[model samples]
Target chain A: MKVGVLHSRIRRDEKLLLNELRERDHAVHKLDVRDRSFSIDQAGDQFATLELVVDRCLSSSRSRYLTAWCERHDIPVVNSATTAATCADKVRTSLALSEAGIPTPRTEVAFSIDAALDIMDDLGYPCVLKPVVGSWGRLMARIESRNMAESLLEHKATLGHYEHKVFYLQEYIETEGEDLRIVATDGVPIAGMRRSSDHWITNAARGAEVASIEVDSELETLVANVDAAVGGGLLGIDLMETQDGYTVHEVNHSVEFNALNSVAPIDVPSAVVDWLESICLETTAVSS
Target chain B: MTDEACIVCDATVALPADVELGEIVDCLTCGSELEVTGIDPYALEEAPELEEDWGE
Candidate 1:
C-alpha cells in the first residue's frame, strides 16, 4: 500500500510513523504542502500508487485546498476536509459536540461587534477568549476582566477577517492543572496520556509534561463516542477533569502522535500504519 | 445624521455607532432584514494594527 503525508516540517513523531510504515513494506511519500507547484498526480507518481492521504499540515488556505482536492478524487483521507474544518474551528466543534450531546464547556459565537459586546454580558467575565478558527492554543487568551474582553473584542472586529468573524467564550472549568489526551482510531481508544504543567494550557506544544495512563472503560466509551461524533477515522480527544466530572475540552482531528507515544506502552506509529494499511486494503477491495 | 443611511441596515434612520450588535435593521429598498456584520468602518483607523512580523 502507498500513502502520502503532507506537511511542511516533519517532526520526530511523524518521522517515527513514516519509518514504521516503510518497515512494514508500505510505500510512504512525504510531500511538503508549501511547494506551490506541488500536484497530487506528481506526488502519487513517486509512490507505487496512492491509497490514502494523511494530512499533517497546519491549517492554511493551501493545505485546506489540497485536502479538498484529495477528497474530490475519492482518495481515502484519514481526516477528511469536513472533519478538519469542524475541528479547526472551536465554535463549530463546540456546537457540533453540543448537538451530539457530548459534554463540553458552554460556548457562544457572535459575528457582529455589537453582538460580541452584548454576548460578553451574557457569558460574564473571567471567560476564555479564543479565535473561533484556530488550534495549538495559539491566540487563546483568558479575559479576567470586562475591560480586557472589550479591548480584545474591538480588536477582533477591526480585523474583519474570517478568523475574527466570531469569538469563542467558554465558561472556564477550573481543573487540577492537568488534562487527558486520548488517541483513538476507528472509534477504538488505543492510547491515553495525562498532561500536567504549571501553565493553565495542557498542550504538548505548550511544554506540558505527558505520562501514559490506563484507559478505563468509561473513558474508552467517552472517547469512542467522541470519535464517532467527529466522524474522523483518527482523532485526539482532550478531556478536562472538572468538579462535575470529565468534560471534553476539544477534539483534534489532526494530531501529532509522537508526544503520546513517548509515554504509551504500545507502538502508536505501528498501530497507525496498521490501521492505514487495513483502510487501503478495504478501499482496494471495494474498488476492484 | 438623521438623513444618512444606517451603516448596517441601510435604513434612512440615525443610530449611534455604538448601538447594540443584535439590533436588527430593515432595508428600505427590499425591506429585507439585515444585522450588522460587527465591523465599524469609521473606527477602522483607530484599531490596533499588527503587521505580520515574520521570522524576527
Candidate 2:
C-alpha cells in the first residue's frame, strides 16, 4: 500500500512516519504543499495510486481543497476536510465540545465589537482572546484589564470589514504544572504526554518537553467523544488540569505526533498505520 | 452610479459617493441600510505582517 504525506516540510513528523512505513515495507510518497502545481493528478501519479492521504497542510483552505479532491478520487484521507474545518476554528471546536457535554473552558463568541465588549464586561477580567481561525497559540492573548479588551476589540473591528466572524473569549484557568496532550485515533486514546512547563502554552510547538503519562478511561471517553463530534479519525486533545478538573483547551486535527512518539510507551507510528490500513480496507470494500 | 432620484419617503437628499466594499453606513435618506459592495478596498493591500516568530 502507498500513502501520500502532505506538507512534508512544516510537519517534520511526516519523515518519521514515512520511515516507519518503509520499515514495515509500505511505499510512501512525501509531497510538499508549497509546490504550486502539485495537483491531485500529480499526487496520484507520484504515489502510484494512493491508499491513504495524511494531511499536514497549515492553510485550512488548501487542506480542505486537497482532502475533498482526494476523497472524490477514492482516496482515504485520515482527517477529512469537514473534520479539519471543525477543528481549525476554535469557536466551532468549543461549540462542538459544549454540545457533546464535554467539560471545556467557558467560552463566548460575538460577531460585533459592541457585543464582544458587552460579553467581556459580563464575563469579567482575565479572559483569553483567541482568533476564530488560528493555531499554535497565534493571536491568543490573555486580557486582564477592561481597557485592554476594548483596545483589542477596536483593533479587530477596524481590521475586519469583509465579514464579522465571532471572536472567542474563553475563561482562563490557572494550572500548577504542564498541560496534558492526549493523542487518540478512532475514539480510542492511544497515548498521552505530560508536558514539562516553561510557558503557559503547553503545545509541543511552544517548547514544552514531553513525558509519558497514562490516561484514565474517563479522559479517554472525553477524547473519544470530541473526536466523534469533530468527525476526525486522529485527534490531539489539549487539556488543562484546573482546580475544578481537566478541561479541554483545544483540539487539533493536523497534529504532529513526533514528540508524542518519543515519550509514548507504544509504537505511535504503527498504531497510526494500523488505523489507516483499516480505514483503507473498509473504504475499498465499500467501493468495490 | 445612477442619477435616479431618491425614492424613499422622508428621505434627506444626498449625492451618492464612490463606495468601496465592506464599508458600512446609515442611509442618509431613509436610514434603512447602506453597505458598500462590488470592490474590496483592502483586497489589493498586502496582509499586515505578523511579528510572531512561531519557532519555525
Best candidate according to TM-score: 1
Candidates' TM-scores? 0.78, 0.77
Q: Give DockQ: model 2.
A: 0.01
Q: Which ten residues in a row have the lowest lDDT in candidate 2 chain A?
A: A7-16
Off by over 4 Å in 2: A8-10, A36-48, A160-165, B1-56
State the lDDT of candidate 1 residue by residue for A129-171, as single tens digits.
Answer: 7776555676777777778877888887786476676666777
Pairs with steric clashes in candidate 2:
none
| DockQ for the candidates, in order | 0.01, 0.01
Reference-based TM-score, model 1: 0.78
- TM-scores computed on chain B for all candidates: 0.37, 0.31
Residue A222 of candidate 1: its Cα lDDT? 82
- TM-score of chain A, predicted model 1, versus the true chain A, to 2 decimals: 0.91
lDDT per residue as tens, model 2, A195-226: 86676666687788889999998788888888
Task: Give the top-scoring candidate (lDDT).
Answer: 2
